[model samples]
Target: MTSSLLFASEGFGLNLNVFETNIINLAVVIFGLYKFLPNFLGGMLERRRSAILSDLKDAEDRLDEASTALSQAKEELSSAEQKATKIRNDGKTRAEAIRLETEKRTVEEMARIKQGAASDLNAEASRVTAQLRREAARLAIEKALATLPAKLDERAQTNFLNQSIKNMSKD
Candidate 1:
């Protein structure tokens, strides 16, 4: 192994000189990168931060608009419910009024019919009474005519006839 190391050192000898290793070039490049990198990266980072802020502002505005719209919708629904309740109450009142009116009319009509029927019955009774009186008067007259000849002689009948004629002339 020592022999191999000696052969390697003779074939490719190590240089101790700094200029031959290019150390100054590496240091200059490192220094330039350190001085320039922050300016470029700072500008990019500032632009990204402003863009994120703008997006956050837009999101907040949209949320406010959505909240306002939801409140308005709730108010409209409440108003509609009130209107529906009012209409239902009015309908119930109207129906009750109609039913009461119908009942009143029915009672009035029944009273009128009953009165009419009673009036008709009274008129029939009065007519029948008058007819019975006429019939009784006719029967009495016929019976007197049939018995008149047996009760009166010819001379008496002649005298009664003369008396009836005199009474009619006086009236």
Candidate 2:
């Protein structure tokens, strides 16, 4: 609206001419800021971008190191597993060998026992045979003594006694 004035209507009041004065001043301020603002804001944005890139680089390096550590750990685990398997196999083989050795010893011991038993049986049989021979000789001598008095005269007895004494002296 026309306030019937060419300048401000009051002391230090706003210039309300939208098309004539305010638009022109606002356009000049916007143009001046646009020219200078990029130099200041661009440096700040560039610094922030550099910081973010540096962080990403450090993260990538850390990831690579972690992957290397993981691979090394896997290798160590595999080596340990192989060693365990070797130890287990060795234990089983040793057990089998020990069992076989024990069996051999047992077999040998049994054989020795059988041999000793046979020897003892042979010795017992020989001793019994000797005893039977002595018993038979004593019985035969008694039978001869009982029949001697009826069968022989006094002179025959005297002659037999002399012969027995001669045989005993020679032995």
Top model number, TM-score: 2
| lDDT agreement of model 1 with the native | 0.88
What TM-score, computed on C-alpha atoms, does each candidate reach? 0.57, 0.61
List candidate 2 stretches off by more than 4 Å: 1-58
Alpha carbon lDDT of each predicted model: 0.88, 0.90
Cα lDDT for residue 159, candidate 2: 99
RMSD of 1: 6.9
The candidate maximizing lDDT is 2
lDDT, model 1, position 73: 90
RMSD of each: 6.9, 6.5
Candidate 2 lDDT over 5-120, as tens digits, reads 44555555455667756788888899878987788889899999999999999999999999999999999999999999999999999999999999999999999999999999
Which residue runs of candidate 1 sit more than 4 Å off their true CA positions?
Answer: 1-62, 152-171
TM-score of 2: 0.61
